[model samples]
Target: MAKDNSRDTGKNTIPKKKGRQSAVCANPLYPCAMTGAASALAGISDMGVIIHGSSGCYYYADMAVPDTLHSTFIVQDEVIFGSAERLTEIVESVSKLYNKIAVINTCVPSVMGEDIKEILADYDTICVDAPGFIGYFDEGWRLAVRELADSIPINNSNSNTNTNTDAPLTDLSKDSKGNIRVNIDGVCSMDPFHKGSLIEATRLLNLCGLKTAAVFCHDTYESITHPSPYSVSVNPDYNCADVMNRRLNAGARNSTDSLLGPDNVLRTFEELSDRLTDTEDAEIDIDISKIESECEETDEILTKEGDRYLRRHDPPRVAVYSTYAYTEFACDMIANYMDGEIVHAAARNNPPDSDLNGGENPYNIGGICSLHRIKEILSKKDFNLIIGSSFEHAAFPDSAFVGLTFPIRHRKMLYDRPVAGIQGALYLMDEISETLENGNKKSN
Candidate 1:
């Protein structure tokens, strides 16, 4: 369990009462950073993940990852001597099953000062120091990527020449056939929406005649081992500084918005099209036209369903608590499909750079929200539709509840369904419309 980074500031002079709200699904008392780190590593197929800690730590992380994982179960005796021998055994076991391995450090082994790097230095391995107590889930995920980034081999001929120069290490474009293939970043299989997000991204990319080189951290180990000079980001939080499309960083519109709606699908094509400078202009337009036609059909279906929804039920006052992209997308669905308004929003990860919570922006409710502070805000609002984790759903039993975030016990779906892109927006709106109709509320 990670400690709350916030210290007990001066005590509030006035005490507040715990309101009569329904007991929402309770969050785990303590969230583990190790779980996030372990899950990230497990997403890569054929990559063996060794959780370096006690068996219990292995169990906890395995609950999230669920496959192709190794555990160094350092017993009490081994703790007294060292975990080196046990780790060696685990590595040997995993090496046979996997071509590459990642050593994820947990609290026990990390605290005990195990020589993990030294022991695995010669092997195809990267050691990510992701002790649970150090940070939160976001930090842990980024740390794992950073650690792997440090160890990833660049096969550029200019690698030696650039080593001593003042140039940045990440700029290996000289060796890259940039824009030939696309790498989709930030949709990890560990996320509740990972599978669906990846599927949608692949579909959208393929629609534009783009060949996917790799879906970073969500594909087989063989796929992720290689690097591309460019990638399209599904989430803004993922580090895109190295291989991201720089041409897309224009002042046309907010970058985050380009990850949410049908317009975003078009934007992605446009951006990637610019990078495909070698392609004939006529050919590029043809590809873009094909993708745009698909979105048009999607829009037609959604618009028809949305019209029926407006006729069937009153627009529910909605509030969303999730990532910025998820929140904004849900808001778009409601306003377009159900004619509803988002009364409030709480962003779980990085705060949005756009006008999500501004008065003019119908898509938002609050300025910025964290997991720690969102509960209080949700309790005070009068929203009838709540889109977020099980916790928020529990708080608003009377509201039209939809779970878009994680730890949702009631609905466990394995199918690929994106909350972004043309299909994603339509799917989410259909869910919202159906929930409203079935929840015994009618305008007629």
Candidate 2:
């Protein structure tokens, strides 16, 4: 058994004010818990995820998740009587196709309380009770990760000892060539930048002489069950490293870092490089100089580009709305690189930590959720640019818009564009500059 160093933080419980009956009931910007659970589980290529609920639940989850999904499609009769038989039939069929089956219980079936575990006792299936009323997308995602963590087989063969007392523990999984592999967490299939961010993070890891071991919910069941001890995240909100470490006893040290912004990317990689080299038994040589050089070059390019944009037009006073991590990153980029002012920054979900801005929130208002609240804020604020999803664009169609969040219906994103590593910083800045310039021209 792995070491259990986890304390009861009550971090998983849903907040009272942010529940289903909250102000976000009307025109909720983010998806519900069911969709979030499906998105996380469906990302596993080998696992067959079944939404054990009505057609509406199944369709909504299927639409949001890019990967293949299954459903029991419980009808009116099943609701009144019981969904156990219907669920069993689907699980039986799906069991043949996949190595493992995961059933996500939606609102109706969850309320039925028919003992899903007992019904699927004969088959190899994992049941996750993530109803729509539980919480928002992030809540559902975390619940699924917690459930998955239970299935991960603990490996006692790997030693958790650190030779260098000053250095952080580096008991990470390695690849065929003996390179330390790092797991990339927070890559959900529903997010538009998922593909691009995954590629960018992998590229940066390779540049620093590290291999990508497992993508949190995106990789295979085998890979996900056996994750690397060391991890880095593209988005901090959907991160599962802490949960994994807490659940698993062996090599369960917190070695995850965030790579959301330019500064975070540089800092995270630098720290990772230092930890690897500090290990006395670490034979694989890592060179972080190349990463530093590339980041510096990218920073110089961003400064020049930002300066060029500022010469033609006034800095864009923007309203940013996304997940907390993304919202912060957008606000930072606009303010730091473009010298723009953030009029308002709204997070779709709650902040991961207590500190909303680390005492540097440039925006007048922060931490507001729901489309109703956002609309109210937009009515008062005067801003040239809006950074969010289609909901924001629809509400304020006249504003200069950049689709950074989900439900991006205005434009078709055929290419896998990133928003994470050095390339990600460049791509994001490029988009912001072009959008600002175009919006300025239209206004003029």
* Candidate topping lDDT: 2
Off by over 4 Å in 2: 1-27, 155-172, 250-252, 356-366, 440-444
User: Which clashing pairs does model 1 show?
Assistant: 24-394, 45-221, 196-416, 196-417
TM-score, candidate 1, is: 0.77
Model 1: lDDT to the true structure: 0.61
Query: For all candidates, what are the clash counts?
Result: 4, 3
Candidate 2 CA-lDDT value = 0.77
| Residues 1-444, model 1: lDDT tens digits | 453222111112111212111111123322356776777778777788988989898887776665567788878987898888888888888889887888889888888887789977767787888887765555577778766656555433443212222333223222353333556776755557766766777777677666665566777755554434445666555443242223222122112214456767777766655554433332222267877787778778888887877786677788776655677667777777677877776555433434423324454333232344445555776766677877665555566777787656556676666776676777777777777776733210
1-444, model 2: which lDDT tens digit per residue? 332211101123233343222423223468888888888889999999999999899998887889999999999999898987888889989999999899999989888887898888888778889888777777788788888887666665534312122333444456556568888988988889989999999998888778888798788987776666678998777887667655665344447788877678889988777776666676546788888888889889989998999999898899888877888888888988899988877677666544533544445324444566567657988898888998988888887788888988888899998888887888888888888888733411
Lowest summed lDDT across 10 adjacent residues in model 2 is found at: 4-13
